[model samples]
Every structure is written in structure tokens, then in C-alpha cells.
Target: MFELSRRNFLSQGAAGVSTAMLTSLTRGDAPVSEKKYAVVDEVAFRGQTRRLKLMQGDRYMAALIFPTDYPTHFRLKPELYPVCTPSGVPVTDTHQYCFIHHQSIMTGHGKVHVDGTDHAVDFYRQLPYPNTERIDKFHKTHNLFQMGPSGIQKIVKADWKVTDQIQLRLILDWQLRDKESSGGKSVISEQRRYKLFQRGPYTIIDQFTQLSPHSQSLTLKADRHSLMGVRVNDLIDPDDGGMMHDSEKRKNPDGNYWDISGNRKAPRWIDCTGRIGNQTAGIALFSHPNNTRNEFYSRGWGLMILSPTLGHDVRVTKDKPLQFAARFVAHDGALAGKTADELSDEFAAVDYRKMFETEK
Candidate 1:
């Protein structure tokens, strides 16, 4: 038998690795078009709150940030308007009184108790805007911040990271901090990604929230509200003929979502759809399997809240911070129908870790 020398073994091993890598690269698992680079731009608006818009490719998504010194304490859905279908049909409602608090899509709703506040914070409704007359003037950023609404969460600051150097996906980042939690610290971290497909387009929103008190514990009552929810356009109002469905195949008839009706049954996902002008479009909330709870505090007035309640109270301290992972899909078309099963099934194939990959 012929024996191979150490140098020969090293050189042959390196060659084998190089050859394997070359073969895999040639297999075309990664397309060059998807890796192509592009450019991005930003636009800002100061309404009742400050809003920021990010234009990536042909799609634009925005955010609403509660400003400093606002009597109410919280940042609402930044995606209030211009959330259109792939063909350019609007999916979000602006200025509807039925449920004025349904501010497009939001990340709030719960009676939370911080160390310094005696009242339970209601992030679900606009406590600051009492009547239709007031709300009409409330959506602008230049308006004054007042009190007498529900409990408010102070807005400390907002930070964002966006880039278009790589194609395939539009990567965006946001880190939001709340005013001193009376006696603690609370923050919301979101990483939003948009993928435009030939079939349609969808946004992948990933959030991580931390509630911690500097010297005390924060208590979150089993709430009917979610930290995140979707508010649809008025045209698809249950009164205007819209459909609300859950993954278990439970659905409410058209115009049924116009009231305070919804399911306590925890499903894997929930969705709502309505015809906007000429196009049929909708939004869906996908509760990841890893979420701690799975129920919806949905409303017929075009609000779908993916919050789960324990019918009791739970305490979260710095040591036991609350965490969650979920996704929202926005699409339009007969092919992009609001069927939770089909959507959920299609979602299972998603590699979230890869989709939400950071820009590094």
C-alpha cells in the first residue's frame, strides 16, 4: 500500500473543500438578481404624531411615533395610510369614527400597571381624543398633546436603521423606548422586511418587547387587547361588507366585523378581507408557534387584535421580561385571498431566520 505524506493530505483536503464550495456556488441556490443592490429614501410628516416613510423599490411603508411630552404615552401604527395593494389599492383606513382608535395597524392594548402610575394604561383606544370633532384634528403632529384620555405611555425616543444595498428584501429596523416606567424601563424593538412577489407583496414584521421596572415589578393584566393589532380601511368595514376568519376555519359573515364581536378561541392565525374600490385586499396576523398565548380580542369595527388573555394577572420583572414573535401579511388579489389555512400553510415554509436576517 502506498502511504500519503502529511503535506499531500493537507493539500488534498484543501482542494476537496474548494471543489465542494465551487460546485455548490455553481448549483445556483442563490440567484444574482436577488443579491443586486438598490437605493432607498425617507420622508417625514408631523401630524398628531411624527411619522416616517421609507421608500424601498416601488413600495413604501411608514411609522407613527408618539412624540415627547404627549399626554398619552405610546407609539401607534405608523402604517396608517398609503398601504396599498400590489396594483396600488389602499388597504388601510384613515379617519373613520366607528372605531376611531383603530389607527390603521397598531402595537398596543392592555391595562398595564407601571410603578409610578395608579391608573391602568389603555393603549387600545384614544383617550386623548374624546369626540369626533377632536379626533378630526388629532392625526396631525403639530397638534398639542393633552390629557384625559386613557392611561398614556410616554414616548422617550425612536431609532431606525434602513438600507437598500442588497436586493431580494427591504430591511428596516426600529427601536422604541417608553418614558421612564414610573420605576422601570420598557422598549419595543421591531425589524420590518418587505418582499415584493409576482403574486403580490407582504410585509414580515418581527417584534421583541421588554418590560422591566428599575426598582419594581410591572404587572400586565390578562388583557383583551394585544400589543399589536390591525385596523382595516372603512370600505371593508363589516358594515360595508368584510370578512373576518380564523385558522380553525371560523369566520364571521360580511358586515359582521362592524361591531364588538370576535373569538376567544385561540387559533394559529386570523385574517380579515374587504373589497377596496375595485381590488380585493386584506391583512392577516400569524401568531408564531413559539408565542406564549394564542387568542384574538378582535372587533367588528375593522380591528383584529391577536392578544391572548389568561383571565388573570401576570407579573414581569427585569428577570422575567415578556417576549413574543409574530408576523403580519398584507396582500391583495383573488389569488391572495384571505384564507388562513392557505396562508398559514404557505407561511410554514418561510424561513424566518433568513427572512429577518440583519444587515450586519
Candidate 2:
């Protein structure tokens, strides 16, 4: 055997070690795995009284304690319409107008305004002109800044389960109260409907549902002699403006009255895109049968708006409680249609007796 020199042996060892280190460095950083859930507890926002908690689990998620207080300086402002898209692009600019009330969650703190007020108006104000009278005149009837009943109680959770396919469930408790108007001739009925929104790796999804069964279905019934506004492609022509004046009316002449074009009236229903976990989701709105104007819908890719007017006429009747119910769901395109249909069925099955049961 040939003997190796001390310097030769040391130099060879050093070279081998350097090569190994270089190889390791060139491999880059290790990949990070996605978390199954995320939890946000007691997140204090600018204008809210209650401490909000958000939880994300493997198959279930929740938002607890939504605030009911509103601030006095609140003014409605414009916000981006159709906040989400099936193409996975979010609307970043506000092009539409809605009320923005202010409030603080915890007491003794100066009032802080939040965007949730604007969101609430944008999400709900979609009825056609004549039908949308109530919401348009909301301020004249009641103070926007005062604290109302707690809309959401305890834990509000949404769950998703995967079998051969994916399924979703939303659970919550809500309250309703009637506030006397200054005129005393009429009363403004307050109903707190639950709103749900989800944004993930896929696209965007927004949905709303009534937490109580006491809510009425969305239905419409105008006076017998009252004119039933002509619908041109998902819009109602309250003014009877001919199709030549409106482009949307020209597109779908045979569509429902609520679908007509040139009709500035808010829509009864809306369909928009929602995103989740590298998948695009579809969102739809449904109403209960007891509603006066049976609900109608607007289907599209970005945001869907459902009008409260679509459920009933806004004539204030003393002691006649105005009831409403709604449901929202997020699903892949494949299940959007089926999910919407099922939600409609569920709304129809709701009864007054079932509405009062305490949720477990």
C-alpha cells in the first residue's frame, strides 16, 4: 500500500466536505405544507362592541359575536360591486353606493367606523325601484347609529365535509325586534339575517341565511289592479321605459320581469363567484315561501344581490310582524345549480313553529 502525505489527506477531506455543503445549499428551501385550519380569537376591530372570534378547522369554521351597534355619523358610501369573480379576480374598487354606519364593539371606547356597514347595505339593497322603497328610506324611519338587538348569538359556524364530494352546512342563532317610529303611525320591523363570506385559494363566495325559522319566505304580490312591471332580462321596468332605452332589456326580452334592463329597480336575487382552496365556488340566494313576493334571482359571475322587497310588500302594519328567511351556500361550479335548488327546497319547508326552536 502507498502511504498518503498528511497535506494530501487533509486537502481531500476538505474538498469532499465543501462539495456536500454546496449541493445542500443549491437544493433551495424546504416546501411548506398548508394548514388545515386557522383561528382568530377576540379580534377587536375599530367599531364593534362584542369580541369577535374566527375559527377554521379541517371541516368546520365559525365567527362568533357580531356587533349590533351603529354610529350616528354613519353615512352611506360607494363600494366595489360584485366583490368576487368566478375567474378568481376580486373587485378592488367601489363603484356602487350603500350606507356605512359606525359603531364600537367594546364600551367606553371612542366610536370607530368599519366597512361592515357598507357591506351590509351593498349586499342587501338589490330590489327594483318600486319594490325597494323601504330600504331606500331606511334612515327616515329609524336612527342608524343606535344599537339594535344582537344579530348573531353564541357561535356562528360553517362546516365543509368531503365524501365522494364536498358538502357544506351553516349554523347560527339570531334575534328580531320592532322599533317604534317617531310618527307612531308605523313601526320599523328589525330582522337580523345572517351573512356569510369566504375567500380562499380558489375564488370568492358570499352567502346569507336566516338563523331562525320564524322568518317568512321571499314572495311578491302587488295590488290586483296594480301594474305588474314588465320584466326584461332579470330586471323590472318600473317606469315602463321601452327596451330601446335599456341595453340589458334588449339582451333577454323573455326573461323574468325582475331581469329587465333599463330598470333601476334593485334585483330580488343575485348570483356571484366565490373562491376556496384552489377551487372556484358559486354562491346563490333563496327565500322562504311565506315571503310576499316569492324570491327571484340574478345569476352572474361576480356578485349576486337579493332584494328584501322581493319577499314582500313594504306596507307597515301595526303588530303584523314582518318575517324573512334566506340561505347562502358556496360550492364548485358542478354543484352550484344543485345547491341552489336544494336551498330553495329547504326554505320552502320552513315553518313558524320550527323557527322558534333554540339551536344546539
Per-residue lDDT tens digits for candidate 1, residues 82-102, read: 454433344566446675556
- lDDT measured at residue 139 in model 2 versus the true structure, 0 to 100: 73
Q: Report the error of model 1 at residue 28, Å.
A: 27
The number of clashing residue pairs in each candidate reads 19, 48
**TM per prediction:** 0.61, 0.37
lDDT of 2 at 230: 9
- The most accurate candidate by lDDT is 1
The candidate that wins on TM-score is: 1
RMSD of 2: 18.2
Quantify all predictions' global Cα lDDT against the true fold: 0.49, 0.29
